[model samples]
Target: MTGRERHGTGARLRRMLAYAVLILFALVFLYPFVIQTATAFKTEPDAAAHPLSPIPDPVTTEAFAQVFGGTGFPLWVVNSLAVTLLITAGRVFLDSLAGYALARLPFRGRGAITAMVLAVMAVPGVVLLIPKFLVLNQLGLYDTYTALVLPLIVDAAGVFIMRQFFLSVPPSLEEAARMDGAGVFRTYWSVILPMARPALITLTILSFQSSWNEFPHTVVAVQDPALYTLPRGIANLVAGSLGAGTQYPLKLAAALLATIPVAIIFIVFQRYFVRGAAEGASKE
Candidate 1:
C-alpha cells in the first residue's frame, strides 16, 4: 500500500483495538450488576450454584414477592421517597440562595462565610456524627422525621456547587434586572433562576441520589422502624431479618429495587449534567 493508505489502515486497526478495550472494561464494570439482577430472579440453590451466570436457570420471582409482601420494604420505600423529595427541594432552594449570596451579594463577612463553606466541605462527614447526634438530642429532634430531614436540607457540597455555577453567570444580567426596578429576590426569582435550569437540574439529581442512598446519617437521625429509609432497612434485612437461610435472592431483589429510582433520574437528566458542569467551569 501507499504511505497514506498504510497509515489509514493502521489507524483503523488502532481504533478497533481501543473500542475492544473499552467494551471489555464496560463488561467488567457491569458484571456485578448483571449478577445482582440475574440472582434476584434465581432460586436460592440456583443463585448459589451459578453465582456468576447472567441467565437464571428456571427463572423465578419468589424473591420479589417476598420483598413486597414479607418485609418492611414498602414502608421503607415510602419513607425514602418523602425524605428524598423534601431534601432535594430544600437543598436546591437553600443552596442556590447561599451560593448566590456568596457569588453576587456584597455583604460583610462574605469572604469568611465562603471560606467556612469550603472548609466544611473538606471535613469528613463521619467526623461530625457525634456532634450531629448530640445536637439532635439537645434540640429534642432525635428519632423524628424532623431529625431526618432538617440537618440534610442544606449541605456544604451543594452550596459549593451552586456558588461556582452562580459565579459563572454574568453580572450584567442581574444589573439589567435591577435597572428595570426589580429587587434582589425579584431579580433572582424571575431572571436568574430561569437561566439556571441546567445547574438546577444537576443539583436536583445529586441531592436526590445522595439523600436516597444515605445510611450513616439515618443511624443517628431516627430509631423508629417506621422512619427507616431504603438503605437503612436493607442493611437490617441483610443483618438478620430473613431469620436463618442465606436468602440471596430476596436480598438482591430488594437492593435492585432500591437502585431503580436513581438510575431512572440519571438516565433522564444525564444530558443536562454535562452541560451544567461545563457551564459552571467557564468564567465570564
Candidate 2:
C-alpha cells in the first residue's frame, strides 16, 4: 500500500479503538442504572431472585405504589424540588456574580480571596460539617429552611467554574459595551450574562444535581423528618423504614425516581455542558 493508504488505515483503526473505549465506559456507568430501573418495576421476590437482571420477569408498579402511597416519598419529592430549585437559582446568580467580580473587578485582596476559594475547594467538604453546624446554630438558623438553603447557595466549585468561564470570554466584548455608555452592572447583565449560556447551563445542571442528591448537609442542617430531602428520606427508607425484610424493589424505586431529574437535566443541557467543559479546559 502507498504511504497515504497506510496513514488512512491507521486513522480508521484509531477511530475504531476510541469508539470501543467509549462504548466500554458507557456500559460501565450505565449498567447499574439499567438494572435499577428494571428493579423499580419488579416484584420484591423477582428482584431478590434476579438482583442483577436488567429485565423484570413479572413487571409491576407495586414498588412505585409503595413509594408514593406508603412512604413519605411524596413529601421528600416536594422538599427536593424546592431545595434544588432555590439552590440552583441562587448558585447560578451568586456564583456567576462572584465569578464576574473576581474576573473583571479590580478589588483589594483579589488574589487573597481567589486563593482562599481554591483552598476551600481543595479541602474535603466532609471536614466542614462541624463548623457549618456550629455557625448555623449560633446564628439561630439551624433547623430552618434558611439553614437548608443558605449554605449551599455559594459553592466554591461553581464560583471557580464560573470564574474560569468568565476569564475565557473576550474582554473586547465588555469594552465595546462600555464604549456604548454601558456601566459595569449594565454590561454584565445585558452583555456578559447573555453570552454565558453554556457555563450557566452547566452550573444549573450541577447545582440541581448536587442539591437534589444532598444527604450530608440535610443530616446536619435539620433533624425534622418534615425537612428530609429525597436522598435523606431514601436513606431512611433503606435503613430504618423498610422493616423486617429487605424490600429491594421499594428502595430501587426511590433511587430510580431520585435519579430521573438529573437524567433529564443532562439530556437537555448535555451540549452546553460539553462546551462548558471545553471552555474550562481551554481556560486552564
CA lDDT scores, all candidates in order: 0.93, 0.91
* TM-score of candidate 2 on Cα atoms, chains taken together: 0.93
lDDT, candidate 2, 148-261, per-residue tens: 999999999998899998897799999999999999999989999988898999899899989989988988899888988999999998895868778999998999999888
lDDT, candidate 2, residue 170?
91
Weakest 10 consecutive residues, lDDT, candidate 1?
275-284
lDDT per residue (tens digit) for residues 1-284 in model 1: 89999999999999999999999999999999999999999998998888889999989999999999999999999999999999999999999998888889999999999999989989999998899999999999999999989999998878888888888779999999999999999988898888889989989999999999999999999999999999999999999777988888999999999999999999999999888877776742
| Residue 189 alpha-carbon offset, candidate 2, angstroms | 1.4
Clashing pairs in 2: none
